[model samples]
Target: MEHDTSLITTIAAGFGLALILGFIAERLKIPALVGYLLAGIAMGPSTPGFVADVDIASQLSEIGVMLLMFGVGLHFSLDDLLAVKRIALPGAVVQMGLATGLGMLIASWWGWDFGTGLVFGLSLSCASTVVLLKALESRGILETMNGRIAVGWLVVEDLATVLILVLLPSFAGILGGTVAPTEETVPLWRTIGQTLLEVSAFIALMLIGGRRILPWLLWQVASIGSRELFTLSVIAAAISVAYSAAALFNVSFALGAFFAGMVMRESEFSHRAAQESLPLRDAFSVLFFVSVGMLFDPQILMEKPMHVLSVVAIIIVGKSIAAMGLVLTFRYPLNTALVVAASLAQIGEFSFILAGLGMSLGLLSSEGMDLVLAGALISIALNPFVFAAVNPIINWVLQRSELARRLEHREDPFAELPLTTERKYLEGQVVLVGYGRVGRRIARELDKRKIPYVVAEQNRELVEDLRKKGVAAVSGNAADPAVLIQAHIAGAAMLVIATPETLNVRQIAEIARTLNSDIEIVLRTHSEDESQFLQKEKIGTVFFGEEELAKGMTNHILQRFAP
Candidate 1:
């Protein structure tokens, strides 16, 4: 009559410890994720007492991954990925290569074999999508341009990792893995082509069929007015698609769930679906962090202190510096570079998964795996501090380094309006800052009424496109007084701040006011508190939240520009 209660005990202990420690972490102004990891470590075998089943904990964490990715998909669309592809795609690929190279260097220095070095290096290359998502969401910047770029970059990393996971098994012998050697050479390109085919098929199906069917299904279920059923349906779709994708298409569970969520987003009730499923998503996500913590063997830190430090340095310092440099090279601003770098500083689920595969293939020793786990734990715990340092570091660099200031505010060929710009746009016109969704809408409204405007956008590429289309736009952060002057703010009838970039909006507004005392100003904000603060400071007309805010801002600008 006896039965195993391992699952129940694992969840109970994990959640209980996570809650207590997480609360303490928050009270101490630390990230709750660090607390969750600590909770896992407490219940792990290495800690000695009442060890939770690591296998069961890992499975539970997978469910969390499925849900967390699904939620991200509900918000992230294909267009969002496309929006940052110019930066994210190249940035992720180059940064991963750099991290891998660094990993290989460290491995070689430690006298590891080539195969072991390759696997170890790759294990450090990818950033955890879950961790990046959590960081962006907590900062209330998940919908911003920078957030999209970071998430898109991680998406590319995940895709690349999935390809590596698939191909690594085929090259097991060459990589010194456990697979027995055969006379036949491993068909490397064949396997890669097959993987691409399967991946393409899965995506096509999700985009074409799943998009139509899932939304319809959600609609049918919601029409029934059963909250329980709707929630069940959403979770069922997430796990089912994830499992099926793994079984049928050789896709990662997280990627499968993400596609499922994206498809479901086409439905009218996508927001409701996200709302109803949040509790489960959050709960499972905690378990994911806990399970990650459980895998750590703290002994590695003590046994090979220098080795552990080296791994941490490669992951936190080496990878971050490389990624930041890549971002800057791509012509992204300093803040984007710093944020992207901070986002890449921690390795998570994929590292553990890759290391496990390495062990099975005999390419990595248990010692190497231990080092990876140690690095993951320490880096993840410190990731919050790294992110917190971004703004301060940016400020410090800008103030202290001439080169850094140029990187922050540099504008060149497209920084100034061309000499041929119409006099109407240079004077008695609206200075439109940002060309994102709100900015686009404002521009369209102005175009309809023939109200001349010039755009000041941080994205140089966007500005280039705008210019090609005969729009008067300058590329640079508006917080730079020179950028404002370039936009002819002194003669501008009104200034419309449309993008929610993390720049000094107040400073930009003050500069605009200083340049043109008679100019009117309008600003868009996502936070009500920020809107209130802006209004109190008389920093133009501040609109808060969503499309309505955009509409109101557009209407106000139109009224001022009315003939």
Candidate 2:
């Protein structure tokens, strides 16, 4: 009369523990991911409680990895990557090299062979995409220049890790590791060529064919008027492409799903697709973090305390210093350098994959894997703190060091607009903040009406383009007093903020009001809470996107009924 309850028990334990711990973590002002990992630890074999099937958990985690990468691809902007390539590409490479070197040195000192050291080093080189995205999104900066740079940097690291994963087995002999007899032995150049060809073919196929086919498939599903079917199609597409990539091209699920999302993003229904698939993506992402926790053996913390410490130092300190130095050397602002540094100060899924692979190849020992897990656990738990410390630490350093102050205050000529001789353009004009999707539309309307307005945009390139078009534009955060002054906010008739930056909207409004008390202010926000708060405070004329959309739809329906 008894039923096989293994799957149900595993699901119940995972979801139940994760929900409790995630809520606690949120209450404690830590990221819910930390809680999810803790839940995994609690239910893991490493702990005393119920042990979920490690094999099942691992498989679930693969789905999590695929979905997480797919979500990242949905938001991936080629323009953003190109915007930060001058720094992100080289900076990521250099930072990873430095971090890897630190790991290798530590491993060598521990008497591990060259192969173990190399594997250990490689595992520590990349940051967790999930952690980075969560941090950036919480801060409402995922669309900012700093966020774009961090994302681009992670993308570079991901690509590098993928290449390493592909090449590792071929080098097992030289690395003092044993490869499976079934493993194909090819010349190094041939392996490299083959890998590149496969990747190129996949990319080409996705970009050319998948872009058209996937969207068409989604459209067909939607036309059937079944929400369940649409969601199923999106999930099926993600998993199917991921499986095919691994089965046919020898590509990782992460890369395959990323390409799928990227191609899907080209469709007009991208937003709808993202919204529909978000719940599944988030659930799997949680499972991914939980599975990571299951691999962690707390015994390593006590047994090899110094080794764990050394790894954590490399992840948090060594990597951060390397990234900050590279960013500053590139003449980016101190804020940007600190943000990028904080973002890279943790490792996650890729580290686990590398460590497992290394162990399977007899390159990394169980002890080494434990150490990597220990470091990942600690570093991830501390990542939110690291991000929280960025501004305060920068302020503290600037306060004590004259050089630091100078660096913070230094302005990049390329990022700032030159003052114009004509004062008429500034006086009695509307000051528009941001130059993104919404701002662009607003600017177009303003331009067509021949309204005198100046744009204050953070994207220097966008500002440059505006200037080229004979429009008055200033390049800087509108929240900054100097930028507002440059934009002539004091004399502006109206101020419009066309970005969903709820974090700084209040400050920007305050600064604008102080500069021109009579200036009419309009602000856009995606959050109902923010809109209500702004309105309650009399901050400005706040527009909630969803509310406006609802109102527009209601009005259209009412008109139809009236006719």
Candidate 3:
């Protein structure tokens, strides 16, 4: 009981440490994951006093993976998935094979047995999906061709990793002679057949049962309108499925998580699940990376520094080469190919699992673990630099030849930047707040006259919907100073605040006055009292939506009377 309490306490403490260190890492322009890893190192067995419960950390890491994969599946639209099919499928398999071959050769040179070498190579083949996704998001390239290819390639890598996770333990048991692949009653082929049958049944249940049942269950809960219950149910489904896959079918939990996500992808509840699971997923992911970092012993630098560096080189440099080859083969532009390659050049979560399993199975000692751990750390640390260099490299390549010119043209089909940046505000134009009924008619008139104007909207969904209709609108909180800055309030010739909410309109008018004391502010309110308050703030124009509708009706009556 004492030991259990201590374990719980350590895990709780480690969680706090991870969060604090993550902020520091962000401030320093380093990956928050690296900070989390460093925090884990500081709290691991090698460090002085603060040790985290390794078992608990491992379990949480599993949950992190499930949620992370689920989110990935949710975001992966049909278009994005179809875009990278050519490269991601064949390229992932070929690249992993090449990496494994290289790793096996290196291991043999370093005097490791074939079994150990195979595990080592398999570990080297994975790329960190979480890290790459975050990097792409930060660069605003998550929807780019390169980003699509990187994600799809990781998806392929993830499937291969799941296979490795299943095979490794079984192989270890067989090679160690603890369990024979073939027993008297069950021949090796028969055992394999049974295993396949089990896997098939499990998959059928998840795909068929999961697809039909999971969505219905979630929808039922959603109908109750209990946010807490909805969030809990999503978590329970993800965790339960992951556990069931591992416990019953002897497959990796990661595979179960992937399937769970794929099945849920068919549901309307996917977006809600993603939003709810993000916080938990991020917490566990930090812990997972930190634990990986803790495994790196700096002492190895003294003895086999060259070997460790070589592994890192292969991971960073070799992976890049393979990725570039695959990207180019798929007919992507040279710029996109380089970005895709550079983005996926780091060792990932599966590497930690592989190394840990190998250590437990007596395939690798502490020294070998240190080398793999060091390689993971060094590769991860350099990943940001590699990503940052991609744009510069692409620019340089673009200036080289005829091929470069074509690639550059492909990179930016619309070479012209938006007119929003030309001046502080969209001058001598009517700024529409909402693109609804009244605002739409006003915009049509403005368009007919060739007037320059900008639309600011607080509703992201609505903004995206309008964008599809070719309306120029920005999305954010109207009350935010940054939003006002982006919309360029200073030089605006006129402002149109049209919304159902009068309070919001008044607040927006106040913000407009704060930004530009000289610019005309318009308040589209439902109440006369609201208009008076807006007018008091030096707003030159005020249009009550209710009054405007009433006047239009009155004018129609007057015209009928004259006739």
Candidate 4:
């Protein structure tokens, strides 16, 4: 009797529900992504009591996707992208091809049209830039080789998505006119050519115009120093370019947003734009995930369960292989390669956009839509678990074969390359690899003896603190050649590799030995087995702390007995 709930009201209700679920997800130590999906399922058309307006939700999600992509572009400088070209370009192309091919094969097995299958394949080929990055960052792996490669690969995937968005509609339109429901003939080739031309021209214009005018516009805006005005202008530019892409050039709004971000990245206002837009981006991005979740009809998984499961399996295997192969080929550690591959084994937000486009163009059926939605939700929900398994899987692989043996090999062709042009410092000094309890104690003892020493510690903060106390410290991994050089290992009287007693310690010790053949090497370990391992390397000294602890305990017991 109060009033009818309009679509807007329904969307608002769905959004509120999503926010609550997201909060719940965070509290439960689960990925917030799961919460967003659960929120969608609760308010979806298939659910009772709170049916959402799917159309409105989808539109809002479009904005969310753009903002998210814009953020990615803002953080990723062109220089960084070019630097990782060895992995970013080839890895992405291979990964996409493999995933898409697997998708097509799976879809074909299910008897779907070849074109529909191809579209579905293409959808599965993409790894979500947002999801993978968030997972890696949360796990504190963003600076590792795995993290770097995954980010580069995702960037490649994003570029592919832009091109696909540019051409998808025309391709579908052509296929549509060629098939049934074409009462009038349409020139497919010319239409496609014109669409491609328009898109290419727009890209060229943005590249040139963005490089020239955007910086100037941003500078002009900055000169005013009005926060409100600057924020308004940035949003206006984002929306204006997005609107133009959709209205004038017939491009996807997301593409325009990406281009706008790329332009904004070059401006001085980049950091401010990123900071200001985050609140809005988060609000919309949450809605997007929630909306995506709402599209999940779990019942469809029961109906077309095999098809969904098959596609998901293909995505995991295909994407993993593509990522791992590329990362390893580019000479990242094997452990890092495995982590990178596993992290990207799921489908992403862009996949949904492709499916949505397919649906609009009649290339996807209701069943196909449901299948895609279910796969996306399941993959996103399970991403944390997949990521968590990376280390364990790597450990297992390390025990299996020679391939794993070489994973930690630091004998790369550039191992001997020195970092600085200046002659080595720390001549006749000792190089200490770690600064842990044993390592640090040893360094102090050496200092008391007046033996000059350099500390090479991976903990950057600890290295800084040491330097402030008038210590010579090199900030980086002991296993890295650059760190050794920075500490002047070649000019040292001795090398002490005191890292944790892990498998990689052997590699570090070997590297130190290779760098200075005449320099004496000492190792500190907690176990007799570790002592034996170091002995095999003919280390000058091996201190087994646990054995000493055991002997002290025995002495105390005997003294008590004699007393």
Candidate 5:
């Protein structure tokens, strides 16, 4: 009369232990995922306690990946992704290559064959999207420029990994893995072609068809006025689209769910959907870490501690250095370089998947998989500490090293405006800080009215494009008085702080006031507390985002009825 309840038991045990350990971890000043992963390791088969169903746990983890990625999609705009392409695209590609090379070199030293080493190298190359999203959100930087760059870099790496996933199976035979059946032996070139075609088709379908259909579906469901149904619709869209993409087009579940969220972002109710999906994402993300811990064999640590150490070095130190160099080469600020470096000092879900796949295809040995898993566990657990150390590390280096200061203040061609700038732009023009969405709109209006403006933006590529268009722009943070002076702020009639709230508005205001006491200052902020602080300081005319939005909507309603 009784049936096995393995699924129920797994959930109960996973959650119960996760909460206790998670609490303990937080109290110890560590990320709670460290606790969740510890909970999994305890319940794993290797530890000889109560081992949960690996199969069920894995499925639950997959759901976590879907939800977490979908949540990111809700906040992440396509424009954000495109905006960082200049740095993210090349930075990811080069960093991955360097990481992969380091991995392969170490593997070869351990007597691994080329096929095994290649798989081993690849497994070390990519960082976890799940870990990154959670880290950024917790730190309240998910919408910041650094966060955008990190997310965009990971997205590009994920795309490249997907391609490798496709082509890896096809090249298994050639790479010294199991050969394909004689009847199904398609040429490598055709496999490459088909894989690209399929990936492209999937992207096109999501961008064109998914974008149009998803928002309409949300509207239809919202009109019904049922909260539960709206939540159900969002969850269904995330899981279903992710499942379908993997089933029909060979895209990764994370990518598919990400697209689903991006499309859902088009709906007016996106904030609601993100809130509704929050609990599930948080709970299942804990389960995801637990499952990852389950895959790790504790013996691997004892047996091949040095190999594990080597792999960790490549992931945490080697890859991070490579990424930092690449970013600095692109002329980003020193702090941006440090943050991104710290961001990538770890590996996660994709590494496990890649190692597992390689094992199945006979391209990797048990030792290889064990090594990758060990590196992942250690690096992921240590990633939070790495992030926490960024500011301290920067300060430590700057205090000790003259070269570091020089690099931080290095000259970029676009850092100064051209000598050909008209006098109108130099004197009594708008000194706009940040050339992002709001600033662009203001610049467009100024252009129409023939009011000259000099833009100060941190992104050098944006400045380059602006200059190419014959617009006056300087490439550096306006927080520096030198950057402001480069923009000729002394002669400017107004200082418009249209940047993200990451800047120290007070410092900028003081700098502008000192440079030109008559200049009017304007500012924008995302936080109510900060807005009040700024207003109290009388730093400028503060525009709190949500307050302004509410006022605009309220005024529109009033106007609609008055006429």
Candidate 6:
């Protein structure tokens, strides 16, 4: 007997093409997302190939969306946002406004209605969180100060987008579009008020009840000691909460899943949850991109090339300029401004979601959706190159303009130590780089042992605190030769780099070696492969955190079983 195999065929074809093209993309030094999108295009009806069922692909995509948001929530840190709130909050809001305004102007030029312009503009405002994080991670800067600010800025944008998703349906009539007409149209204020109330109630429930129940549920499942069961529980919680929120409270699935992951973060099992669920989350995420590909009409590129270019400019140029201006206005260093701007110069998953919602509500036309997708494809494809160009661009500008050089070299009193007769602590001492978690512990142990050491930290506040406590400290990136000079690396006995910035470790090591050829060097890394490479190059004593932890645990167990 023959059986219906449409679902199986769709899954097989989607994953197969995605795998092949994704590998090719990586080999070509591009993000695998580009490959996934290409795969989807190949299987889409627009490409005249084996078209997967759009409806089935869409359902799978929804699951992917929920899982993707869940993973994001797991990594979301309130502390990180609060750390950069002074810059992130206002910067995100202002930058988003500028991008939106540009988008609206372009839409108006194209003769679209105000509602369509609003939706299109909002879609162009936010950067893709996935793409940004990946870029930062690859560069080993995700833990840097600028990275934190960028992540925090994106969080603000995400929250704003969630609010828009909630209120869009309510204001559908006023926006000059309606998915479905109501018996009597509700006043705009009334609709907004109702949405706020329901959202508040749902948020309260998640924070208050979910905080207690979800952890308890995970704890119970974990006690069963079954990995499969634990993974199932995580998936279930994400999907159930997301579906219930939409069904009962009229909240978006993305918002619901985000909250679920946030609440789950309070659990001791949060790391395990993230680790186990990653494979599944990643699988679904690919499907989500694939489904997005299916919706694109490639003729938009040929039919409206100028419109596409305008949208791309809004995303890449307009948004970037706004972010850079905001960061500079906040008195951040030019390096920080450049990094943040580069990070936000691409659009991704959230843009697609907003476009789809607008289209469903009749607030955005097919042409608008196509333009958004086209803009996303081009911008995402170019983001890495944009980041790669930041340093070169900054260098070129500095060399050409004295004003640029002055701005880049502007002194921060807090970040520089005055040269004086206090020279005793700067000689024959350990120069410890970074003042973060690992550096702090090392400092404390040295203090307890009465060892002379000087801290070279990037955070001015941290350096100030160290000095107040009578510890020798200088503030600036260790990778800077001047900062190393300030730390008296030439006279120092050793250099201990406690930061996990893999990309800069080699530079710091080389600088220290150049200054003091016989200085003992120690470094830390998160990747075993990186550690092996460093060790092979004789870059100094290297430590991989996980490997060290395993060794320590083994010693403890061996001691327990001692003969």
Which candidate leads in TM-score? 5
- lDDT score, residue 235, model 3? 77
Give a tens-digit lDDT track for model 2, residues 153-233.
Answer: 998898788678766766776788885655446556776677778888888889889999998998888889999898888
lDDT of 3 by residue, 1-563 (tens): 33458656756776778789888878876677767777777877777886677777766666776676656555655554544566678888988888888888998898887877877888888887777887888886664445666888887787677766666654565444235435534555665666667778888998779999888888999999999998888878887887898799976667777777778778898888888877877776776776665666777887888899879988988888987877666555677678877877888677777777778776666777777777777787788889899888877777777777775334321122146444423565556776555777778888897786777764444555565666556765465565666667776777777654454565677788787777676657667887677678656677776778899999999999995
For residues 1-563, what per-residue lDDT tens digits would candidate 4 score against the true structure? 67766666756876778778878877876667767878888888887876777878777788777776666666766654554566678878887888888887887878878778878888888877777878987886775444665777788788888788777777775454133345235676876798888888778988898757876787798799988877777777777887888798877888887888888888877898888777877777888788777777788777767777776777676677777877777666677678878778887688887887787778877677777777776777677778888888877877887778786453443333234422333688888877866777888898798888888765444565676676778766677677787788878888887765344566676777788878887777767776887777775687788877888999999999995
Candidate 5, residue 250: lDDT = 75
Each prediction's TM-score versus the true structure: 0.88, 0.88, 0.69, 0.74, 0.92, 0.88
The regions of model 3 sitting more than 4 angstroms off are 1-4, 70-79, 173-187, 360-364, 400-563
lDDT of each: 0.86, 0.85, 0.72, 0.75, 0.86, 0.88
Model 5: pairs clashing at backbone N, Cα or C within 3 Å: none
For residue 481, model 5's alpha carbon misses the true position, in angstroms, by 0.6
Worst 10 residues of 1 by lDDT: 179-188
**Best candidate, lDDT:** 6
Instruction: Compute the lDDT of residue 480 as modeled in candidate 3.
Output: 54
Worst 10 residues of 6 by lDDT: 178-187
Candidate 2: clashing residue pairs, number: 0
RMSD of 6: 3.4
Least lDDT summed over 10 consecutive residues: which range in candidate 3? 408-417
In terms of lDDT, model 4 sits at 0.75
Q: After superposition, how far is residue 500 of candidate 5 from its true place, in Å?
A: 2.1
Any residue pairs clashing in model 1, and if so which?
Answer: 177-361, 178-361
Flag the better candidate by TM-score, 1 or 2: 1
Taking all chains together, the TM-score of candidate 4 against the true structure is: 0.74
Clashes of each: 2, 0, 1, 1, 0, 0
Between 4 and 5, whose lDDT is larger? 5
In model 6, what are the clashing residue pairs, if there are any?
A: none
Q: Report the C-alpha lDDT of model 6 over 251-288, residue by residue, as the tens digit.
A: 98988999999999999999999999999999999999
- By TM-score: ranked, best first: 5, 1, 6, 2, 4, 3
Off by over 4 Å in 5: 72-76, 134-144, 178-184, 250-255, 557-563
What would the per-residue lDDT of candidate 5 be over residues 366-477, giving only the tens digit for each residue? 7887788778778877888899888898899999999899877887899888999888899999999988889999999999999999999877777888999999999887
